[model samples]
Target: MAINILLTDTSSPLGIGLRNKFESTTFRFVAEHPAELSWRDESQVREYLAEVKPHLVLNTIGWGEGTAIKPDLLADGAECLGRCLAGSSASVLHLSSYRIFHGEGKVSHTEADVPKAASDLSKAFAQAESAILGALPSSLVLRSSWVLSTEGGSLLARLLADFEAGRSTVISEHWRGTPVMVSDVVRAVYAVTQQIIYGANNWGVMHFGSSDVCSESVFAHKIQDMVQAETGRLLQLEAIETETDNSAVLEVRRLRDCFGLQPRSWRQGLRPAVRRWLDRRGLLAEVDSAVVEND
Candidate 1:
């Protein structure tokens, strides 16, 4: 049977990339953004859920950059949606972040890792996860790292911004990530939802991402060289700090063994991000002007 699913993805910039890469192959999806819902709209949604009896409710709604909005709202809204769909056989896939971890020792965090969220946003999300885990035990929590969109604001955007302005941008040498492409994450999430592997019974928190750990400096150098070789302008990588900590490094062993998920290499993921960013900024033609000498 074609599973009927409703997806909330207000922060979707990867557009058809998401729909094409995953959604089309899986559930019969009814996707909506944040603006599409309301207290009344939720009542309507509940009615629709009761009437349609969807097999799953996938929420990818989040706020990182928009109006001076509170991050707690996203968490709260997600919790509310979870509660509303409670006991409908429509399990949730909460897309949480690795940023929630405190920058402590080299912790290969697991489902049992103590919650040590540092910032307000992270705290809010942590709180939301608590609510979901506490209430709907069937929900799946995916803690992801540096999930860069192939076509959006990410490490690539910030780097491209500096590169285009003729400023010598320095990628923090100390910063490191597994850096899963958003497309890959989306595909994995779709699998989690549609029961290709773990479904409602696959309880507990699980880490997900490609299996490549590279420091931000190394990453920057690779991207800079890729751009320069493709165009001939040099970009620099400087030793610096990344707020990201070891907890976010994620003990992805669970996902690896369970799904046999062979994530693409970060190099494969990054070149496209760089190219996309360069193309979006119209710096593709003037790739030489896109950077300064790295030292």
Candidate 2:
């Protein structure tokens, strides 16, 4: 049976990506943005939940830029959504961030490590997770790191734009994480939802992302190299050191054990991401035409 899913914050990057990813018969999805519920309005969220009465509420809300994470807003919204879903049978699945961790030690953060949210954005993330989990016991809080996709003007798009303008892009040499592809994130979430639908009855926080870890600078260079390989355009990249401890490499053992998923390498996923970016800019056709002309 297809689960009726209510997706909140559909206007955000992740929300939009979720919409694109779930365009199939796997599950029935109804999308709503912040404009509908507004901020910290528990009554609005409660009313919407009553109207929808969905079997699963996929709360992908609080979609902000990677650079700017608003914790207070996120926490309030999570609390509101959690309270709304508390009285219903709808299982809530909330997307969280790895930025909640301090990323202090060299080892990757496991589900066990205590969260040390250094920045206000990360602190908000931590609070939000707690609020939802407390309200909805059957909720699944999946914390992900460096979610990248080809849709919209995401960080990846911004980087490409900078490259196209002949500007040297600066990538942080210190910041590190297992940058997961947003496509993989969608798949992982679906897998977990399937488990829930089938009565697996396991719900709590878990980490999800690719297996490998790399510095932001390294990842940026990989993107540059891949684009060059595809379009023959060399982009100048500048690497710099940073004192910020925003780095987090996820511990994915739970993802492997629970969902039976060993995530694919981010490099393998990058081709499609870059292809999407080029397609969005209409440069994909240009690249194809150039290839044909050269041939």
As a whole number from 0 to 100, the lDDT of residue 92 in candidate 1 is 69
* Runs in model 2 lying further than 4 Å from the true structure: 32-35, 68-70, 103-106, 151-155, 282-287, 290-295
| TM-score quality measure for candidate 1 | 0.81
Best by TM-score: 2
What clash pairs does model 2 have?
none
Q: Using Cα atoms with residue i matched to residue i, what is each candidate's TM-score against the true structure?
A: 0.81, 0.89
Q: Compared with the true structure, what per-residue lDDT tens digits does model 2 show for residues 186-258?
A: 8888788778888877788889877788887888887888777766788788877666645668878776787
**Per-residue lDDT of candidate 1, residues 1-295 (tens digit):** 7777666554454334455555556556766434555522457556656765666655555633212224666677676676677765666677676766645445456666767666676687687677667667677777877766533456655566567777776666555667777667777876666563334367667787667677666767777887786556767545656665443466687666666666667677667667666666666545344452221
